[model samples]
Target: IAKIYTDKDASLDALKGKKIAVLGYGNQGRAWALNLRDSGLDVTVGLERQGKSWEKATKDGFTPVKTDEAVRNAEVIIFLVPDMIQRTIWLEKVKPNMKKGADLVFAHGFNIHFRMIEPPADSDVYMVAPKGPGDTVRDYYVAGGGVPVLVAAYQNVSGKAMEKALAVAKGIGATRSGALESSFKEETETDLVGEQTILVGGIMELMRASFETLVEMGYQPEVAYFETINEVKMIVDIIHSKGLSGMLRAVSDTAKYGGMTVGKKVINEDVRKRIREAAERVRDGQFASEWVEEYNRGMPTVVNGLKEVDNSLEQKVANELRDLIERGKPKK
Candidate 1:
């Protein structure tokens, strides 16, 4: 079983005087820098000299130093950048100046587990990933609560690397919520698969198929939009409060029976086989490897993916769904 380091074990003294560098003042980076600084730790924000984010970081009262200098000066370094560019940034700007035995941390494990980047032998490598998005993490912490987090120490060159990781979690108000232990590989693979299946890929396909089916059977495109995509939130709300059985009980018996019968046929043996295949593609890293490789070749994959997700027909359908939501549902 994985060990979850809880709040009772966290100590502010653990990072009291430690100089913590937050590399990349993006969403996670900004929140971490703010919370860590408020906790009285010496914190610095590192970013390239360009970009509007530099001005924002400065206005937020952090000395936005060059990447190299920040790594050299801080005792602990947290990288909060995008997954694809991290390894490159590390090799170019961070690797050289990283202090001996400096604690190198990440919000995601992409670089470490995949051998995308290797830290110097003298550095301590770790991760402290929030289970939620950046805004949720920050807002919950400000309210004296915290989103759950995952922490792992990949290398302990500092001998206290695990302690430092836990302490940082405390600084960000994670331990008071919950922080589970996971390896770099486990977190990385699971995160990728989760995004590929439940969050992005599978959900998108399900909505598209549902919409097309409704519209093909003579439903108006606007009605199809409401019946298929726009009601996703209502489904999720029911699922959130109750399990599938409870959700079934809450719906009208006619709708419940239809859902039970038609949903099974829609996701029958062939579709279930396809779903398994899709998950296997993620497990084999066909998706991640392609994404990262495309980045190394200048992000053609991201460009294409964005283009597809934003095409005209999809945009029209999405807009119609938004309008339907605003107009309120027709008489049930």
Candidate 2:
């Protein structure tokens, strides 16, 4: 169960004196450095000496140091590296530098829950994962808004796990909107399944299969683009504006009726059962194990899957649609 919080719960200034080391100058790292610096905290970005992000961090007014130096000094160590690489870095660079009772934090629970990165015995392990992409999180902050956040604590070695996690949420500006507490396992599982099944992996396959089905039946590429890919935004916009029924209300009654009738035929109980079974795999940690194993084996299949996407015709069509959308943007 997650204990969620709003703005009144605590103030962001609680981390004022802490030396925060954001390991890895990637998406979450940069955004956190910006937000935490603006919040009047001592913030440093840890990066490889030869890495491009060091220059970017220095340009943005951050103290950029090698991973070892940063980790050794910071009172709070925030691991913002990629999931597959974090554990290795932790074993090599982080675990040794951590002092007793320092806070170990994360933006996501994948590495922690998968046991990829193990923390020191005396430190607290908690999370403050924003429920959006890194760009969205940064953009929201710029607009004086904030994205929803999920905070989790797996350890309380110093009895400040929950409080420290909340402090982290505040530091990153997640408290401007709200934060929810969840288990490391739940957040990790939901996040992975959400990516692997619906958002990226499965949705791409579904969209391509649908478009291919239309084109193989003699639909024009332009028409298929409009109906399948181009209109995706329109459908998504309506879906976001309102629920599924609201989306139907914005469509033709015939289309709605056909959707109600034929949609079930296409996505029947068997299909739903398969989805449930997949969910079961997630709950049972099988999905995490498989993904971790794939990573450990040098990510051959994962690289191949990415190549499959790059070579996809759908990517080509999507790029064209994106260009048209960009072209229609108002002149600066």
Candidate 3:
């Protein structure tokens, strides 16, 4: 059986007297640092000396220091930086400065799973990944709730890696909801596949295609935006609160029928085949290799793709519609 942990299952005692270094003041880093601090854990923000994050961290009441300095001082190092540069940072700063027997924590499994950032045998390596975005992580914590997290231990040199992982999850408030055990490979592969298929790439293409079809069929841009783009959140909200079948029952019968039928048509067997292919690429590391090459080349394809997408008529219309809605809103 999968080990699912709650706040009662994980105790903060495992983390007592441990000074935490949160390396990266980006959204996730900031959220984790604040949440851990609020949990009565000692936390420090680590950043590049000259970066904008230093100022942001300082403004948030943290005495942000250089990455090496923070790593040298802390017993637990939570690496929250972008994955592309993790190996570099690990080699040049983290590994050299970190103390023997200290814990190395990650929010994602990418670097460790791919063997890009190998820590020494003296360290404990683990992950405690919150399932939601950073904004919601902090927002929910402040509201006395928390997002779920996935916990995993890649190396247990300290013999208490699982305990430390669970402790960190509790410290960040994730155990207030739940923490599920996952392997590094499983988490990394599933996360990549989900983003490339349904979450980011597929949804964007679906919205754009639907909006274009409506506009081409002589619908007003405003109406097309409302149908294809604006109402997506409302539908997704219902799906989130309830399940897929519950969402269908809550809608009009005509809508439910059309959605049930047409959704299959839109995401047909051919798309399913492609989705399998995409997942295969991720599982075999082809996607990760390609992304690394893209990042190394300064993301030329991504830059051009973003420019093309942003310049599309759908985006232009969507911008205007969004502005109109904003203007129509009542002041608080």
Q: Global lDDT of each model? A: 0.82, 0.81, 0.91
Off by over 4 Å in 1: 241-246, 278-286, 312-314, 320-332
C-alpha RMSD by candidate, in order: 3.4, 2.1, 1.6
The regions of model 3 sitting more than 4 angstroms off are 326-332
- Give me candidate 1's TM-score against the actual structure: 0.88
The candidate scoring highest on TM-score is 3
Evaluate model 1: give its lDDT: 0.82
Evaluate model 2: give its TM-score.
0.92
lDDT for each residue of candidate 1 in 195-264, tens digit (9 for 90 to 100): 7767887788888887888778888877777677778888888887797877888889999889989989
Q: What are the TM-scores, per candidate, against the unseen true structure?
A: 0.88, 0.92, 0.96
Please tell me which model should have the higher lDDT, number 2 or number 3: 3
Better of 1 and 3 by TM-score: 3
Instruction: Tell me how far the alpha carbon of residue 278 in candidate 2 is from the true structure, in angstroms, after superposition.
Output: 2.2
